[model samples]
Target chain A: MRIQSLCAALAILALAGCAADPAPTEQFRLTEQALEQAKAVGATDDVPELKLAEQKFTRAQGSMADQSFKNARMRAEQAELDARLAEARVLTQKSQEQLTALDARIIRLRKQLGEVQ
Target chain B: MSVFKKLGGGLLVLGCAGLFGCASQGSESALQQANSSFQSVKDDSNVLRNAPRDVIRAGESLARADRLSNYWGSGADVRHYAYLSQRYSEIAREHSNEAMNQERLAKLELERQRLQLALREAKLLSVQQQGKWLEEQIVSLATTETDRGLVMTLGDVLFDTGEADLKSSANRTVLKLVQFLQLNPKRVVRIEGYTDSTGARQDNLQLSRARAQAVADVLIDLGIDEKRIQVEGYGDEYPVEANASERGRAKNRRVEIVFSDEKGRLGAAR
Candidate 1:
């Protein structure tokens, strides 16, 4: 009976371990999708946060492959947030560039009108 | 068998305790604060409208944080997601603020351009009005625009026959001409005198020259710059009509004052 209880306990612990550390596939996929979205917004070229997010996402994939689910999840969450930040930064930069171009156009028009030298 | 049972019970107890430990989530207040901050930002109309993508990203992060806390009891990771959610929401709000500022600047620039155009139009209109006033003054002088500029005829009635001095009655017309000339100092004047065909050529030439010089002297006395006046005598040449008629001879014995171009340069007689 004692041998039977030990075997049962070992089986339960093994099952719990398997359930608890499921590969973090969903988190990895979500982070990759977020990175793609950032790239779509030109974040990859214009925003440093995007590159950092990519690095973190790659590290998260490595952790997931190593069966470090908790670390992988944490890094994936971080990567997702970084990608969002990058998207926001790229949008702000684009708006600022448009405003700058408009200002230059206004100055040129003002000069043409002889309002400015 | 008894040792095995005891080992299994101990392991079960330890596992239960560990499960309880994981269940006891920390950073609950942190997650709550982040949610509250995000809610406030999302409530802003500008952020909701202008930064929709950023707002959606923030919502997703907040949802992830909620899931991590409720399903896994991961305190530190939940707090991180919450923080990111709050940060992203704030970024959206910041983007809204910048967009609004840029829009306002664009509107102000457009208004500035409009006002400048209006001012330029007003200036041009004022110059045109001044030109109209000058045209009216020229009409009162009986002057006509010509290739040379404005030409005003001083009939021979202003001087006695065979005389070089101007009649005192001509003062009023001379004064008006003087005012017009003073108003347009950049314009020069040329005075030309002619005679009828009755006089000898030499005497007529000398008399015409004298009459032209006398008229020029009057203009100088009236404050016109002496350097801007030129005097000439045509001596019965370039008649206005046939000198055989008395009325035509009266017209021929007259002085004509020609105004110069805008640069004060007078054209030669045609």
Candidate 2:
């Protein structure tokens, strides 16, 4: 009877291992949107985070094709965050460039004011 | 035989547990790293203020990872949630940085505007201080008030020989003209160029026009409206003196600025 119970417990463990997670269609959509938004904000492939996001998103697509719902969801979720980080980084860089340009203009104005005075 | 089978089953369970324990070690460090990242961002008031939602998501993911770390054979799930939590924290930090930069940009833009205004006012004030004396000098230089209008003569010395570029010596006169135009916004001027009778007629005409354009360009650069100024080249045609002597030719090679009345009505072109 103990041997039978052990076999039954092993079978339950195997069943649990094979449990199918629901397809992460919503996650795939969210990942795609994040990538598109990053691109819209001028996040190019040169950005490391954007490149990572693209690579992971492609792998997530592969997982989806293989019906590995858990893998697909994890990869997609990470890719979404990576794309968002890329977008934020690009915007911050652009703002920094603007600040530099404005600073140069202010310096020039100050010099001109000095000359005027 | 039944004892042997039970021992084998027990060994199988031990082997599975050993495998999970090994995987859990790797995930344990990942959970720790993610928890630290989340803790840093969660405590940053700027991050909390700028990216409350992302911070909350990071905390939630870290909690989920922490819960999964306690479960046997859930290493993959624990690591996945840890990775997610770490990414959320990083994203939160970036968002806060961007927000702070935007705030600084706004403040810098305002400062730039204020400085620009101060510079403009300082320039106008300096010009006003020199305006009266410069006006007298200009009136004396442009003494010929013929039927054409009030005409000021810029002698050839203001430019290099055969070149249209005005020298630095012309800056004061140019600034005075700019100030005069700014003060009398309704007044317009026609800049006419004349050359000596020494060069070829075609070349002289082109040179005269280029010289006139150079002066007009300086006026435009100094903030005078292009519409208020007309340019013309009268190459050796209407000389103020004969081209018979060096003195006469020197007098003839000049640029004449014709000013309109205060009503913005320009005199008819020559």
Candidate 3:
């Protein structure tokens, strides 16, 4: 009966994890994949963030795969949030990209104009 | 044309919709007050057009959140993210509009100066005794020359090399024009940006816009009415000379400042 109670407790914990709302599994996968890609881009300063996201997600996926569904679900939720923070860094990088590109264009144009003039 | 308008309309609509979605939530969310740092930052941006220095700093801080939009989109704590995103938009619009207003006022001053100069030019050049003949001559000469209508000239230094900005001397250049317009209070200023043939068309368009905006910002900073300024970008489409020459390209990378006689005040917050 004591063992049964422990099992019941674990099951309830698992349900709580799974029931956490407002995001989808697909979104989780995207974050995971994006984190992986970010890792491959070695120069990216957000690698630490991606790594954190990756670690959380991997743990979450592991628990779910092992049928510790509640634990897995909780980890998954945490992982999703981590991935989003990392994604924000990615967006900031993208915004800076425009400024960089603009600078480059000006250089090239001025060079070309100098050559012609 | 309608299709282009529809697409642009769609983006503006989406932006506004996105803005309001968070606004309604922010109204109800204790999160606004819960995060004092972010909340102070969010609240501080609201002020007279020349927002306090601290307020400007707060607005700049929200722009730093551009990186967090991905997580911001997720369903987890969405209300919080939405509120932050809306705040970012508000800050950008607020500062940009304020800057824009300053540009218009400066341009008006420039026009006033130009009028006085034109009068002097007319007095010297006009054979007639009346100032009317001088005005006629000034008007005639201005219209005949397409490139001379207050547009930045070829070889005119708009910016320092390797920069996406106006030169430091741009302040004086803009101020001189502002002083010109201050002498004549009845003109509207039009700011147009253009680029030479050396860059990709799309980028050139943007470059032109930045150049124009740089001038306009200076004008607004000089106390030009924001409402009286009209900013547009023409990119490389109307190059005055062949891009095949350096001089021509130099001329192309320019901004035009035109004065309008319309008496309507600009920017009553439409």
Candidate 4:
């Protein structure tokens, strides 16, 4: 009975470890995807926050390499946020540039109309 | 002891059910948020066309999230797919905004070009009509449209014999000319006076000059700008007919008005 109880305890311990210590693979994937999203929007050209996001992603990779999954997950999550911010920034910048060009063209057209009149 | 075992089993079943319920709730919230984000931009044609792949990806991810939340009972996968759905939706929204802006800008550019063309055509039409009206008025006056310019005669009926003073009856003819000059302010005119060969040369010259000056003064009074009127006297120099006949002499005693070109400059052609 003592030996059987010991085996059961060991099995429970193994199950607990398996359930509690899963690697943050999904989080890492999410971070990678977010970074790709930022890149797809040309964040590298105008988004200053993209550099910070890259740094955080590199730190996440370092933590993952060291098997510090909790730390890696935290860094990856933060990197994802930074990447999302970079994407939004790039989108806003591009919109503003297009709007400014449109405004200039409108002004030029208005001046042409004035001359015609 | 059997009752206690039954109770323990029931509690375990209940606990598992509770855990599953919590996971389901979390998945539901994520799926809901993702679906709402997708719906927000679904109607945008720009999003549909320019970012078609992104929009489709978002829809597919949302569907997967819904399936995971409803059946798979894996909150992790549900949340992952839901997040992807929302992210792709964002990308679609961004591209859609850009496409819509481009379309609007193109429309504005076209509108401006159209308006400019319309204004130019209107101006051209107005100029053509103005030129036509001026030509018609000159024709109605029985004036000669010569290469030198328009020439209209104010006969000796406008002045008494051997006198430079204008009679009141002359005002009717002069008023017609004033109306014409007022309508075409850009055109300048020269007034030349002449007389029969019966009078002494110096007297005829002086009388002719006085008569031309009188007409010019009256034109100025009638609002024909003085700067546009030039007066000269020619005592029997250019005759329209022979001096020997009474009718020819009557015609020679005249004041001829010459209208200049658009620049108000009378050329030396006449």
| C-alpha lDDT values of all predictions | 0.79, 0.89, 0.54, 0.77
Task: lDDT for model 2, please.
Answer: 0.89
Candidate that scores best on TM-score: 2
- lDDT per residue for candidate 4 within B207-270, as digits (tens), equals 8788889899999999988999989998877888999999999999998888887678796733
Query: Candidate 3 on B1-270: residue-level lDDT in tens?
Result: 667556755655575566456544443343333234444444544443443543444444333332332332222233334334433333334444445444554564465455555555554443233333433444453322333233333134858642447777666556656655564456667777878877688988887777777778878888987776778778788776888988887766777666554253332210
**Candidate 2 per-residue C-alpha lDDT over B39-154 given as tens digits, one digit per residue, 9 for 90 to 100:** 99999999999999999999999999889777676788898899899989999998998899889889989999999999989977876666646666778866478798788889
Cα lDDT tens digits for candidate 4, A1-117: 455446456656854764565578998898889899999988883465678768877998898888776557766766786687678667766766877786786677667656656
Please provide the root mean square deviation of candidate 2 (C-alpha atoms, Å). 9.2
The weakest ten consecutive residues by lDDT in model 4 chain B span: B68-77
TM-score of 1: 0.48
- For candidate 1, write residues B184-236 as lDDT tens digits: 66888899899998879989988888998999999998788899999999898
DockQ of every candidate: 0.12, 0.51, 0.04, 0.09
Off by over 4 Å in 2: A1-18, B1-11, B139-183, B187-270
Selected candidate, larger TM-score, 2 vs 3: 2
- Give me the candidate number with maximum DockQ: 2
Better of 1 and 3 by DockQ: 1
In Å, residue A13's CA in model 1 sits off its true spot by: 7.9
